[model samples]
Structures are given as C-alpha cells and as structure tokens.
Target: MTATKIAIVGVGKIARDQHIPSITRNGAFELSATVSRHSGVDGVENFATIEELLAGRPDVGAVALCMPPQARFDAAWTAIKAGRHVLLEKPPGATVAEVEALIAAARDEGVALFATWHSRYAASVPAAKAWLAKRQVQSARITWKEDVRRWHPGQEWIWQPGGLGVFDPGINALSILTEILPQPVRVTAAELQFPDGRDAPIAAQLQFAGASGETVSADFDWRQTGPQTWNIEIETNDGQLKLSSGGAEMTIDGKVMMQEADSEYDGIYARFAQLVAETSIDVDLAPLVHVADAFMLGRRIVVDAFEM
Candidate 1:
C-alpha cells in the first residue's frame, strides 16, 4: 500500500515527543518534510516557515500543524487551499471564529481537515464512553493538577495572551467529558485565576449543565506538587466510575474495569490517512468552543506572579 505524505509544522515539544514517534510507528504515513523557525529533525527536508514548506514540498498530501493554537488557522487554510489535507493539534485555533473560517475553506476546496483531540484516543477512553452510554448519569467531576515547571519546562507561550495556561491541559479532560456524556452540556459558571504577571489563568473551576439534568464540576490547576493528579469521577445511577492517569485506567467504584497502553498520536495519524483516502474532513470543535466560551464569558481573577 502507498503511504500518504505529510509535512509537520512547528516541530515543537509535542511534535517531537508525540507526533514524530507516532508517525514513525504508523505505516500509513510518510514523514515528508518539516516547517520550523529554529530547529528541524536530521536528514528530513526543512523550511523556515509554513508558506515556504508548502511551496517547496508540493508533493505533501497533508500538513499536520503542531504549532500553538494562535497560529493554527492560517497554516491550515494555506494547506487546504493548496489541495493538501490539513491536520490540527488540539484546541485547534485561537478563537472559535477562526476555525469556522477554516471549515468553510475546507468545504469549498473539497479537501480533508482534521482537528485532532489526542486525549479522546487515550487508552481507556472508548471503553469509558461505551460503558457510560449504557448507564444513567447523576453528576461528574474532573480534577487535573500538575506542576507546570515539571510538565512544561521553559515554555513561555502558555502564559501569554491568547495562550491557554491551565486550560491547555484541562482541555484533555473536556475532550473525554464531551465524548462520554450521552447528552449535550453547557457551561453554567466558571472562574479563572491568573497569575499576577501572566495573561492567562493558571487555575480554573467550571460548572456544566447537561440536557439529562446532570451537573459536572471541573477543577484544573498548574500548581500541584507531589503525586500529580489527573482524575475524572462520574457518579451514575449504577455506581461511581473513575478514570485516572489521564484515561489510561478506568475503575468502577474502585474496582478496576479496563486499562490499556496509549497510542494517541498514532491513532491520529491512522485516522488522518483514512481521511485522506476518503477525501473527507473530521474537525470537532466542541471542546475548543467550550474553552473559548470560558475565556469570553467566565469570571477572571489575578493572583500571585507565576514563574516557570
């Protein structure tokens, strides 16, 4: 079988640690070239900008944009306009409004566009979603806390304006929450706590109201110390369901139900190949929309100055 050629943009932290390894393991894709301002992988062709990459590597069938959310839409639109399928990293674009523009462009060009949610492909996520589909939900809670210094060392964009600080990690939980919930949910209340010297919040608390009359509360913080926690608990009529370690494991009332290894980025590549073959698009912006809504409508506060 022939492999679909893909170009990697940004080539930053996530692209190197996750996307590169996943692309190497997936047989359906070929790493054609890269676009990055500072660094590029050895042997592969490189360009300093997305425009240059697309112009130089005309054979690239698709481009996976691993840049920050702020720079997503223009790269996506450029690739899609050039007849190349576009793949977007999570929190797709800066504003929900820009992604809508990309969607319109993708449709008019008759090409594929994928806004990837790597967390949805987490080890136990499908199982949890299926299990919940058969049960009656009561209420849900999500807690994600981690030390920013350890997880994102030396990264500064996360604290800048239009950057997503705590929501950067918290959006993963939202992906899973939106996927497993049987009914649509709307944010009822939200509170964001920003560091004194930062433009983005370092902590957030959110409340959601579901069509099934269930309430979900989410707390995300980047100040955790020991035993960093990323857990989501759902209280249902049947029992309590818990997904911990960022959906790597699931338990029902403390009884282990299912667990598996994660190949989220690999799954993303495989799906991208399928979309390329079908000449279709799969871009789910619900999770991102919620984040934007939180930014636009949620209450905000400034706290102590955050470092690292």
Candidate 2:
C-alpha cells in the first residue's frame, strides 16, 4: 500500500520535536509537505500558509494540525472540506462549539478526524484505566504544576485570550480522568488565578462531581520553578491509586505497579493512522468541554504579573 501523504500545518516546537519524529518512524505516513510562515521541514515542500499548501499539494491525503488551538479550527475545517483526514493536537479547538462543527464537517466530507490527547497514550494510562474500571473510586485529586518558561519559552500566544494558559496542561489530566473513570463528571466549582496583564489564567482550582457521587479536585499552576510536578491521586474502595510524572508512572498503595518511558506521540500517530484507514472520526469533546465549563463557571482573580 502507498504511504499516506501527510502535511504538517505548523512547524513550531511541538511539530519539530514530536510530530516530525513520530511521522518519520510510522510507516503509514509520509512527510510530503509543511505549512508554516517561518520554518519548514528538510526534504519536504514548504508553503507559507495552509491555503497555499492545500492548493499546491493535491497529492496530500491528510494533514496533522499542530498549530495553536486558536488557529486549529480554520485549518481543520479547510482540510475536512477538501476531503483530507485531519489529526488535531490536544485541546482540539479554541472552543467546544468549534470542534463540534469540525465533527459535522468531517462527517459531511466522509473523512477521518482525530483529536489526539497525547497524555492519554502514556504508557501507564491504559493500565491505570483498566485498574480503576474494576474498582470503586471514592475521590480523586489532580496536581499539575510546571514552569511555563521552561516548557513554553517565548510563546506569547499562551497568555492570549484563547491560548488556554494553565489549562493547556490541566486538560491533559482531565483527558486521563475522563477516560479512566466509569461515569461522567461535571465541574461544580472553579477558581481561576490570572496574572496581572495577562488575559488567560495562570493557575486554577476546580471541583468536580461524578454521576456516582464521587468527588474530584484539580489544582493547576504555571508558576512552579523547582521540582515540577504532574500527579494524580485517587482513593478507591480497595486502595489508593497514584499516577505521577504525567501518567508515565502509576502506583497502588505506595507500591509501584507500572513505570516506563513515554511514547505518547508515537501512540498518537499510530492511532491517527488507524482512524484514517477506518475512515472514522474519533474526536472526543469531553476534555475540551470541561475546560470550557471551568472558564465559563469559574471566578477569576487577578494575581501578580508573570514575567517570562
């Protein structure tokens, strides 16, 4: 079978670090072209914009959109309309409604649409989900704190209105939670802390309630400097489950149950290939919906100015 000709829509840090490598290693895809304003992949045809790339690369059968959530909807809509499969990075779109529209467009075009949550493909996430499915969850706590300067660097778009700030990483935890838990959850309360002069929040605390009456709380902060942490702990009828290192490790009752190197992007590309082959859409709106809910219902507080 001929490899699917895929074009990457963004050539930012994520596209270079993860998406490029994953695509190169996966036999189901070929890096045929790139759409970027400033950078391009070596040995691939480059275009200054998505419109130009779409028009030029008629052989391109799919597109992987690694652009910011704010710009994702337009590119995705265009690709779906062009009858090309699309793979979207986490936090699919700027809003829930936009992703819903993309779903409808993909269906109308009869093409695959995959909204990938890389954290969901972490090595231990499936095992953690399996373990929780057999047990009764009593309560859950999520703590995801990291230094934005170290991770995001000089990306100014992150502080903009639709950039999603702290929720960028927080949504990853929500993705894992939504996938592993047996019942659906809804946000009950949220407190968002925004740094002065920034449009988006820098930290957030959220309370959630599951249909089974289970309570889950999350604390997301982008101000941490030392000892960055990404952890989720859950209490069950049998014992306690803890997933640390951003789902890279899992422990039960303080004993390590699973630990391994993460191949999240690899898994993401593999799944995208499968979705493209099946001509199915796998865009889950649960995680993005929860983020939107938190922003809608949460109270905002202005804090100190964050200088990067």
lDDT winner: 2
Model 1 quality (TM-score): 0.97
The model with the greatest TM-score is 2
**Candidate 1: where is the Cα deviation over 4 Å?**
none
Tens digit of lDDT per residue, candidate 1, span 1-308? 88888889998889999999999898888998999989998989999988898788888888889988877878888888888888899888888889889989998999988888998988888889888899989899999999988878898988887679999999999998988888878888899999997899999999999877999999999999989888999999999899999898999999998887888888888898888888887888889878887887789998999788
lDDT of each: 0.89, 0.93
Give the Å shift of residue 100 in candidate 2: 0.4
Q: Tell me the tens digit of each residue's lDDT in model 2 across 1-308.
A: 78999999989999988999999999999999999989898889999988888888889999999999999999999989988999999889999989999999999999999999999998889999999989999899999999999889899888998899999999999999998887788999999999999999999999999878899999999999989899999999999999999999999999998999979999999999999999999989999889999998999999999988
What are the per-model numbers of colliding residue pairs?
Answer: 0, 0
Model 2 residue runs over 4 Å out of place are none
